[model samples]
Target: MPLKSPITVVATSLLAAQALAVSVHNWWDVPSDFGNIAELQSSIRVPQGSDPIKTYWMANGFGNGYMGMQHNSDTERRILFSIWDDGQGSKVEPIRHGDNVTVGTFGGEGEGAQSYLVYDWKAGDTVYFRVQANVNEAEDYAEYTGYWGTDGQTWNLIASFRAEKQPYWLLEPYGFLENYGSDQSEIREGYYGNFVMINSNGQHHTPENFQFTHTDIFNEYREVWDQRLVEQGKEVYMRIDGPADQGAYPPAHH
Candidate 1:
């Protein structure tokens, strides 16, 4: 079945008052590998600012088992990476030491090599590093695919490729469905809306703008659900909220 057209809904209460700046790009583009080694590095010369800087990296596991980082150090000579084996899952955290920390090979099966890392800055800091790799096998594409979180533990969705085209992809926060409990009768009686759409561009338009073009898209989608409900002698209602505040992710380094 066609996946439900992806939708992003944000709660008003969670919106932030200030706008944040974010810039993303791929730093490494190479053939996926099983044993061949590669290094992805970047340097952001820290400028003067009070914002904390945060860096993130992840492997997409295309032709390789997974992506891992090694030998990470800041100008301050601090060990940002750590190696640990939790028995349940063995991987590096913060940063890993030793020249021998090896990431497993993906055995050349599905997506070749995919991974990514991001650096969040407060305002004027420069950071740089080389993400090195050790590969044994190789594939065609090695685009980065991963997400980072405010805390190391919980992560939000960052980006992913479209199923077939593979050329088209999207980047946004993870979405969720709001469940209105057992009151089936209440489904249509009061305010009943299934989804919310957020335009990251922050451009708000009236119903007329939507009626001419963008508006028709949602109307069509709503019609589909309405038809199904009507067939069952049920009632369904949908409401489109404003270009509500789409909260920004925490700055990478603040």
Candidate 2:
């Protein structure tokens, strides 16, 4: 249950040849045994990328799933954290609050709206993120907080908001790598480790504590290996190969 970016459409017509769609995600969802989650924290190596405007990675913690850390080709290669609300009913979108400034907003077609805040993060730095939830007793609401910093010792508050709808404490966390540009030569890589989720009752869970599954954008009828994940000891890593050889393996772990 990593954060899922809105899918991008690269081609509009069959005549468009090279403007094919491209995207990849590696995810690990919280199992039913994990129960209600209070907070999730992880240290992710900012991927080495050639084009800052075309390739990116996100290490995220999901609450009510629509929230967590984000790094994309947009916003000039800065880090972002966002909170989202279901885009239907009496819920107006959550407004930006706290010390975090708004970087962007996304919502449409009956989907929830996401308000993102920016941070100065460079590639190759080991950035840590934490997504935690709290309840406002007066209003009987859920507040989600996002934090980020170098390593995991110190954390800077990034963003927080009260969900339009009360969110339960069940954080389903995941990580993903994507290359949106048409250039197939540029490769993006991220090493995700230290995945820890604290359940509502304050029980902590790690990658070593649960069984995981690997998923990719594949067409079983035609056969394609678009993306995947592999477990390296206690840590998990991801690879995004462009639509090509289904038999090609992920690049050796760095």
Candidate 3:
């Protein structure tokens, strides 16, 4: 059968007026027929405005948590990855930790386990991320592992989580840029591309295309901020600027 075009979704909600910036999102809805996705890899770089706190370059995002680098604080940076729990209150089970990873449980957005490593990551430095999972849909479970590094360097193992009921594969990929800080006045941007997936049958693929979208929380203060997600073949640019009194994540800014 021929592959079908992927779908894009724009999530909307209310946010504090003019205080926090809206989260921008992008998706490459690559469906899988070959088999369950065994692994996925991609890269990202921030050529400008990477110094602000709560600026998350979510290079790998999905239905639940995300994986990428963040400006968590003025003095701290991290390679963060997390996956949600099974709704029945089954938290993510810890499987492994690389070298200096911190593993803990998280809530608020969703219940799940999270892992991170503090590194002095800088702007304009391209970082690569790869996620592989041992999935068993028949058993309705999976164990996911995330790794990160630069070219020609050993892949740094972030951590792994054994999901009891959260069976997942990297078939549908979502990446986004978010300015979670109170100051939405700053401009933030990123370049995301080279999305490749390896299937359970050892097939490798590059998604046919991608789409850009934002939230649906409508407000008159929408004009105070703007977000653009432009796709250039295999790569896409995610940018956000703001200070809107109240707004939403826009759509079709490709």
Candidate 4:
């Protein structure tokens, strides 16, 4: 049987401190058609002195997308996160990519040409974000990162992910959910539970299924992080409760 949800409380102390004062922008609001024309030319904004350290973009070919980071000498260190939607069923998969490496193959189609970049970044650094399409032909969309509650309907935008030289960046309504450990196995008997089951229709979750709680004080950590982002002028994206557009990304890029 599935284990019960861990009894935990989320805190907002730490989050309040690290928050930035920035507004999320819509991806369609930015310009497009700036591939390889400039370094960081999307709707997003990064402070000076720091270059783009990492980039996530769609594979021009056909397998999975790519993630890339820049070195001191402006060289790139890239890796493939996974093949075929980056192991996620989402419209866009965050895959890793770099030079001459055949990361993997897509479920269907010929091959994927992944690409990305990374630059110099440091703690206390803040940058603007906007989500855009993988390619010019793909649909216009935005990228967002935030949190999800038990309801999973309301969502806020903690950060935006955008493409370089593009006019707009995707605006994700939810913040990033960092899940640690494997959900397949239970760490401790009553201390924690296994499995996190989400309803196919909504974000509704069950604790017994390991679908509602975290092992390491998730609530407190999340609250702290959320507060920090808010203090930084960043807002925590939350969904009130409803079905999100799961078909945002097109199949061509996947």
Candidate 4 per-residue lDDT, tens place, 95-181, comes to 332333332234332122222223333312322322212323143322222111122233212222332222222211111222121
Alpha-carbon error at 60 in model 3, in Å? 1.7
Query: Could you give the candidate ranking by lDDT, starting with the highest?
Result: 3, 2, 4, 1
Worst 10 residues of 2 by lDDT: 6-15
- Model 3 lDDT vs. the true structure? 0.68
- Preferred candidate (TM-score higher): 1 or 4: 4
Candidate with top TM-score is: 3
Q: Candidate 4 — number of clashing residue pairs? A: 86
Ranking by TM-score: 3, 2, 4, 1
What C-alpha lDDT do the candidate models reach, one value each?
0.20, 0.51, 0.68, 0.21
Per-residue lDDT tens digits for candidate 2, residues 54-123, read 6545666353433334445466445556544443342424444436556345443123334555655666
The candidate with the higher TM-score, 3 or 4, is: 3
Question: What are the runs in model 2 whose C-alpha is more than 4 Å off?
Answer: 1-21, 29-31, 47-52, 63-75, 89-100, 108-120, 135-140, 209-233, 241-254
Candidate 1, 113-137: lDDT as tens digits: 2323323322232222222222112
Query: RMSDs, each prediction?
Result: 19.5, 7.4, 5.8, 19.5
